[model samples]
Target: MMLTKEEERALSGEYGEALSQAMRILVKVGEVLGAERLVPISHAHASGVSYATIGEPGVHWLESLVKGGAKVSVYSTVNPIGFDPYSDIIKVDENFVKGQIRILEAFEKMGFDTSLTCTPYYLREPKPFERLAWGESSAVIYANTVLGAFTNREGGPVAVAAAIAGKIYEAGLQVLENRRTDSRIRLGFRPTDAAEWSAVGYAIGERIGQGIPRLEVPPPPRDHLKYMLAASAASGGLAMMVIEGVTPPKTYLLGEEEKVEIGREDVEHMFGSVEDADLVFHGCPHASLKELVELDNLIKEKVEKEVWVAVAPRLYERANDVIKSLSKKGVKFVRGTCLVVSPIDKMGIRKVATTSAKTYFYLKRRGLDVWLVRLRDVASA
Candidate 1:
């Protein structure tokens, strides 16, 4: 593995033994991945720190970085499992809270902002085409694919180390060559619809854990693109994909008339049947302004209804005035909790109905009561 000047210097005992050990691990990782250089990332968001059931490695490593006097830019955002101030969506056990605070306190000390949710894209405001290094599996995929942001599926400590060193090991998605699509899976859907696209992503990702795909779908609605990215990131572990005739090479490389056809049944086989949920959830990746607007529109017509909903802090700020008006009518706007990370039974929420394929899978892994509901149905009810 190639090492940076700073990394070499650390090996020579420049940044102290502890720092050297950390950088040594990074060097080994870079070597294994065949990365040639190091590139500084503008932002970061890490996941797997918020443990509802057991240990949180995210918290452990972050505290170490902070105690070691790690440095990071202020714009960096974090995704973790935590409490929701507004809604009773998640319950943080005492031990989990201690771990969370220790990790976050470290971040705070190191000049990082704790966006503190899985959906950092919705909480931390960044324009399209911005580059960030995120560690959370789904968040990395969501930020890079759906939002058009740049990120590689990096690990938790590497994210902190990237922040501390003001750079990341050039590997996977970081290199332009690595970004090329090695394999392709075609879709018969629309990149325009967030929900359908999300469903397709869920279906495909469940089947192909690490395959880079090219999607061929029908023309879709505006919000559907969000879910397409969300579901794929949620299920497939996909960090990025090129929409056939829409994304870069697929759209640009093919001259006037060149498209491949994939069967619809192929799409169905990607996601297995999931049922038995009690509450409906959206915004697993982070609710965008468009989705929030749709939610506002849906709530206006809701009469005898109560669904556990969570949104991003960044989106919450953008739709503040409107959400304030909606709150008077009865909509629980939660800031820092997700259905997957929350203690459902403690909140007295035994069953959950959701449109998110990612949420459905994660919840089902816990052996909880989760029902799959269409987004449109949740929109009305």
Candidate 2:
């Protein structure tokens, strides 16, 4: 691969140890992937922020970069942490707090924007064709498919390297040829809610795993689409999905791509089985302001069971009144953390109900019994 004089200098340590190492990481990744050159990125969203998930090794690695005087070179943000920074709806043990604080300090040292949500696209809107290095799988799919931006499903360290260097290798989804839709998915029914959308997404993902699948159905609302793609990625490792009307046509080519049809029965089968739930969770990718408001309305008649709504701090602030009102009615608001990353088992939340298919899949792995339900019907369930 050819490199400009500045890039070569950075890799050779002229830019200081931290940046030099970061440059080396990106360069090596580029070489491995056969990327000829590095592409400038408009943004970078780092994942693995939760202490409960990343633990000591993650903290140590991040601290080393901070001690080396490392900082992001471009607009960058972090994923959700282990707990809410502003509020304490969920309990945290002493050991968890000690480690979580260290991780937070390291992130702050690197100048990561504490928007602290999986959905960085909500914070810094990506222009069509803009390049980004984002870690969260849901965000990666959304950026590529919905916003018409260019990015692969980068890992935590790779995204951090891109942040420090302000660039990433121009390979994978960054190239137009690689973004081609390889298969078509025909939907028999339009998903009426997040649960149905998630079910359909799961079916498509199970049938067509990695490559792009063009949906024949009309585009659902952005909010619904977010949940659907999140579930698909969780269930079947989908990085990019092409919707017939939603995805920008010019970004992907569709020629002789295999076609598959998914019916209502297939979607129902993917919904999984759990009749009753002890607790309800929302916002696997972090709730949007609109979602928070809708949740508030849905829980007007408080039930015996606890309902946890996880959201980004920015969204919490934006929808302050609604969230506060819901809290009064016995709804719990968790900031900067979702059930998937946080210690749900520690909280004694064994039986759970949620609208996110992604959350259902993950919590189940932890041995929690999760019931899949739509947001509107959650109260009745």
Candidate 3:
């Protein structure tokens, strides 16, 4: 991979051992991916922060970087952990807490904002055409597809390395020519809500694999777009897609290839029948302020089952009054963690009812049964 004079110095250990190692990692990754050069990034978000997902080996890897004096050279944020640090909302074992604490400390030492959320865009919104090295799947898709920013779905360590070096390999979604839409997918029926949009995304992913699709659909709600992106990432490993009106037109080139049509019936088959669930979860990508408010309004009535909703630390702090009111109605607001990474099964939550296909997708991987429904339906059920 080609590098600037400053980048060469970083690789040659002029900056320090940690930075040199980070530079080396980027160089090797660039070479393997056929990147022509390194590009400076404006922001980064590191994943694999949860002990439930990354365990002792991940902790060791991060702490070793910290011991080598690694620190973020750019604005960086962290993903969710296994549980809430300040509350008993996610009830995991003491051992789990201990391990998660070490991971949190390591990130803190590295100068990362411990937001503990998958939606880093909520913390610092990226501008169109801005370069980012984000690791969280949902965030990467949102950056590339929604905000028109440039980033591929980075791995945990690679994102951290980019954070320290403030640079990433110029390849994948960073190049404008690479982000062209290869196919046309038209929605036969409009999605009614976020859950339906999520289901549509799941169906699309299953059908089109990694194809760069341009969707011809109605203007979905903002929250629905979040669910759509997360579900697409979960089911298809999709890094980016083009929405009809949302995505910037100039960012990606359109092509006339195979035309795929998706209808409501197709999405209906993907959803299983809803039954009584042990728990109800929301916020796989972490709830936005608007989502929290909507959820709070929905659950003003009595709750029959245990419900958990996770949000970013900033949202948790800013919406304290609203959160406290929701807590009174039996809605537990989980901070620093979401249902995807948390050990909810250990807490006797084997069956989950959720409004997110992304949540359903991840939970199914853990041998948990999920019932997919709209947010209002979940609230009323």
Model 1 CA lDDT for position 191: 37
Q: State how far residue 294 of model 1 sits from its true place (Å).
A: 1.2
What TM-score against the true fold does each predicted structure earn? Answer: 0.82, 0.96, 0.96
Among these predictions, the greatest TM-score belongs to 3
Clashing pairs in 2: none
Q: Which candidate number would show the highest lDDT if scored against the true structure? A: 3
* Pick by lDDT: 1 or 3, better one: 3
lDDT of 2 at 49: 84
For model 2, how does the per-residue alpha-carbon lDDT over 250-291 read when each residue is reduced to its tens digit? 887775689799888886744543356778777877888888
Compute the lDDT of residue 291 as modeled in candidate 3.
Answer: 83
Model 3: ten consecutive residues of lowest lDDT: 269-278
Please report, as a residue range, the 10-residue window in candidate 1 with the lowest summed lDDT. 249-258
lDDT of 3 by residue, 1-381 (tens): 778898999899998888999999999998999999999999989998899889999989888999888999999999988988878877888888899999999999999998888988888889899999999898998888889999989999999999999999999998998998887888888787778888988888878888688887776887889998889888898988898788976778777658889888878865653357777777777888888778778865856677777788788899888888777777777888888888888887788888788888888888998868777765654
